[model samples]
Every structure is written in C-alpha cells, then in structure tokens.
Target: MHLILEQGDLTTVAVDAIVNAANSSLLGGGGVDGAIHAAAGPRLLEACRELRRTTLPDGLPVGEAVATPGFDLPAAWVIHTVGPNRHAGQTDPELLVSCFGRSLDVAADLRARTVAFPAVGAGVYGWAADDVARAGVAAVRSWDDANPGALDEVRFVLFGPAVLAAFEDALASV
Candidate 1:
C-alpha cells in the first residue's frame, strides 16, 4: 500500500473511504468526528442512529470499526472507529494500533482502493501526536505487509502542523 501524509480536513478528501476518529456513540462529537458528520450531512446521522438502534445498541467499542455511507461527502464510505481515550484511563498503544488496523480491515473488506485517515487519539483524546503517528505507521506497515496488494493508497489526512510533522517523521523512519 502507498502511504501518503498531508495536513488537511479529512472530510473533503476524495477517497474510496475515509476513517472517522469516532466516539463509541458513533453519533457525532468534536474534531475529525464532528467535521465528517457535518460534511456527510443528515443522512449520515440517520445511518448512525440506525446502527445504534439495530446492530450496535451499546455503541461501537473502542478500537473496533464499522462503515456507513458518506452521503454528501466526497468519499463513498465512512469507516468509523473509536480511539482509546487516554484521559479516561485507556493509555495502551495496542489500542491505538487497533484503531488503524481495524479501520484498514474495514476499508479493504469494502473493497476500497484508496482510504484516508485522521490522527486517531491525537486530538481531544489526549494522545501525543508522535505516539499516535508511530503506532499508526506501525499498524499500517504491519497490515500492508500482511495484505500487500489489498489497497492502492492509504492517506493520512491530518488536521494541523504538529500532527502532520509527527506522521512525516514516523513515515520517514519507515
């Protein structure tokens, strides 16, 4: 898989799928989650609500992922995964890796050739950007190694300079 990194809003990226750093509720929250929800419009919320009402009554679990139609957004599908909240006593790096790994799995299962991702757990969730980047890169590398021809591109659509820099550094070492 090709790993691309850039600082931008994930909502506007035109990929086969974009991963949302969602809360377990999967309704809508701040940061990447909020931006994606807003960009995808009301139908996205309805799909999430239906997800909650039918399949995921207790909400999506941290590190696990699910997909929804992107609606008004540029992408065809939105892969939603809940990152571990460090401030909430979830500080495991494996949890962070799981977010990336599972999101990729969902994207591949959807047969999406190109996917975009946010810096999961690196915003309001309280994880350092460096740590998040490192884990994310490592997860992508591992997944790519296991499934070499599964994807055409994996893009990290970051929000700020700091996060982009972290991914740049991590990817450089890869």
Candidate 2:
C-alpha cells in the first residue's frame, strides 16, 4: 500500500477501512475518537463493550487495536487504535507508529483495498502534528514496502490545515 496524502472528513472517505484514534477503553472519548464514535452510531459503542468483555485483557496498554464495522461511516470497517496520552515521550513515538502499523495490518487482514488514517496522538494526546505526520508517513511507507499490494491506497486524512500541511511535507520527504 502506497500512502496518499489527503485533507478531508474521515467519515466521508469511501475506503475499505478508516483508522480511529481510539482510547484503551474502546469507548467514545474526545477528538478523533469521539467523532468516529458519534458518526458510527450507538451500535459502535455497544460493539466495543461486547468486544472488551470477551477479548480485551484486564490491563492492556495503549498502541493496541481492535476492529469493528463502520455502522454509519462510508468505510466498511473501522480500526480502533489506542494511542498514547500527552507527554508520553519516546514510548509515545513508538506506540504511535505501532498504532498505524497495527491498523494497516488489520485492514490488510480484512482485505481492505483503501484505508484512511487520522494523525494518531496529535490531538488531545498532544503529539506534535509534524512529528505525528513524520512517523505516520514513515510507518506507512515501511509497511507498504513490506507488504506490497496489501492495500491499494492508504490515505492520511487531516482535520485541519496545519496537520494537512505537516502531512504534505512528510509525504514529500518520504
């Protein structure tokens, strides 16, 4: 999957899957997590709760991901990836990269052709937008090379101009 840079609403993407910057609880929270939960309807929350009850560990850390259907969004599935909180340091960087990589792997497992990913950890998590962009682009590039044609398109969807610009710069460099 070759990464493509795009600035748009994630809910509107007609991709096979969209990566949601979710919390460890897998429940709705603020930022991209909340938006995705809201758009996906109440069923999404219910699904998360059920999944947590059966499969999720008792005290799992962040950077883990779970997959669910997109109840209302255009994409067929949603990959809920838990990113680190503010000031998490180097661990945050690696976790953030893993978030992207894990989401891609989930998408690939589902045979997704196109996938959209938001800037993981860049909102309430307080990761610098530029750093997130850089790590995300790098992770996607590496994954694409390692698993050629695993996905046809991988889009970086930014919510704002600043994030979009950062992703554009990162994409150019990669």
Candidate 3:
C-alpha cells in the first residue's frame, strides 16, 4: 500500500472506502462520524440502525471495525471503527492502533484498493494528535508490509495542519 497525507474533509475523499472515527454507538456522533453520516444521507443512518437492531445490538466495540455502504458519498464504502476514549480510562495505545489495523482489514475484506482515514481517538477522545498519528501510521505501515498489494493507496485525511503535520512526521519516521 502507498501511504499519503492530506488535510481535508474525509467525506469528500474519492477512495474505495473511508474510515470513520466513530463512537461505540455507530449511530451518528460528532466529528468525522457526523460528517460522514450527513454526507451519505439518511440511508447511512438506516443501515447503522439495521446493524444495531440485528448484528450490533450492543453497539460496536472499541478498536473494531464494521462496514456499510457509502450511500451519497464519493466513496463506495464506509468503514466505521470506535476509538478508545481516554477520558473513560481507555488509555492503551494498542487500542488506538487496533482501530487503524482493523479498518484496513475491513477494507481488504471488501477488496477495496484505496481507503481514507481520520485521526481516530484524537481531539474529543482526549488522545493527542501526535499519539494518534504515530499509532495510525505505524499500524497502516505494518499492515501494508504484511499484506503487500492488498491496497493501492491509503490516505490520512486529517482535519487540520497540526494533525497533518503529526502524520507527516510519523510517515517519515515509521
């Protein structure tokens, strides 16, 4: 896989899949999750509701990922993953890394050649942007090394200069 960095709205990224930094409920929360749900329209919520009613009645677990159609968005699929909430005492960096790795796994399962990701566990989750970037970049790089041609491209679609700078540093170092 090819790793790249871009500071932009993840909803508009033209990839096969975009990773949502979702809360456990997966019902549309703030940040990237809300943006994605809003951009994808009502069907996205309905799909999430169906997932909840059927498969994920207990809501999605932290560091795990599940997929739904992208609906009105540019991407073909939306891969939602819950990040560890540091305020809730979920402080392990491994948990944050799992979010990226598992999302990549879902994208690989869907046979997606390209994927975009947000800064999971960052901001409101209480994780530093630098920490999130390091874990995310390392996880993706590790997966790419192990999987080889599984994906053609993976982009860190960050929200601002700070996060983008962190990811850029991680990409260079890790």
Candidate 4:
C-alpha cells in the first residue's frame, strides 16, 4: 500500500509506532527527536540510555532500527533509526531510503499495522527536504512491494509546509 501523507503532531497519532529522527547519541536533540522525547516523557530517555549501553556503535546502521516503549505518547512504541548526516557528498541517497526501509521492518516485527514517520535527516542533519521526501517514498514503495497487506497505514507526519510539499510532490510522481 502507498503511504499516506500528513502534517500534524506526531505525539497525537494513534499508529502502533512512530519513527524518530534520532542522533547518534540517542539522547534526544533538536527537531523530531526532541519533540518525541518531550512527549514520551523522561522515562523514554532512561530506556534509551539502557538500550544504548547494550547496543553498541552508538546508533543502529542506516537500514536498521532499535525500538523502545512510547512512554507517554499515544503510540505504543518508538522506533529509533539513525539517518545519514548531510555533508559534502557523505550522505548516500540510498542510505536515506534505507532509514525508512528499516524503520518499517522494525515496525512490522512489532506487528504494527500503522506507523507515523517524521521527515528524516531534514532538520539538524541538513538534508534537503525534497531529497528526503523522494527517498522516503522509494523506501515505502519497496516495503509495500515486499510485504503486501503487511502494513495497513503509513503516514508521513511532516513538521512544516516545505516538508509537506516535498512529500506531496514525491507522492505525486509515484
């Protein structure tokens, strides 16, 4: 199924899980990470810290995810995935796609039918919104192809109009 697009508060979504655009620390920084952490409450940080201790290399690979309880948010769980940092050609476009791919994989494993995702790598990482949107659409298309009927709903919860426009444009092409 193709992913749905929306601009809203991720904290209020009723999906089974939500994807956070986390940093390497997993401690919660600015943008979506901070918003998720704040909404999920302080316990979320402690849980992340515990997960961090066991899961080495700081963050999971580009196409993988680590999950934690939602704590206080409406969702049941939070799937934290580390996205590529945009810099002088360092960020692979494929890795950007992988971030979405892996997040869905993790959500599927949790038996989640619906998921909400923030625009990955768009804020502090400095990835262009349009590029991120394209990658996200490609990732969701790949996932839907592999697992038909596995995901009932996927929502791209954009933070702003530019991000929403990027996703809309990408979705239009799909």
- Candidate 2 lDDT over 1-174, as tens digits, reads 557777788878888899998888887898888889998899999988888788884522577777999999888899999888776553458888888888888898999999999999998888899989988999898888899878889998889999999999988887
Residue 142, model 1: lDDT of 98
Better of 1 and 4 by TM-score: 1
- Model 4: which residue pairs collide? none
lDDT of 4 by residue, 52-90 (tens): 788654656654678899989999999998888876354
When summed lDDT is taken over every stretch of 10 residues in candidate 4, the lowest stretch is: 55-64
Measured on C-alpha atoms, candidate 3 has an lDDT of: 0.95
Task: For residues 19-108, write the lDDT of model 1, one tens digit per residue.
Answer: 999999999998899999999999999999999999999999999999999999999999999999999999999999999999999999
Q: CA lDDT of 131 in candidate 1?
A: 98
Candidate 1 runs further than 4 Å off: none
If scored against the real structure, what TM-score would every candidate get? 0.99, 0.94, 0.99, 0.95
The TM-score measured for candidate 2 stands at 0.94
Q: Over all chains combined, what TM-score does candidate 1 have?
A: 0.99
Of the candidates numbered 2 and 3, which has the greater TM-score value? 3
Clashes of 4: 0
Candidate 3 residue lDDT tens string, 47-83: 9999999999999999999999999999999999999
Worst 10 residues of 2 by lDDT: 57-66
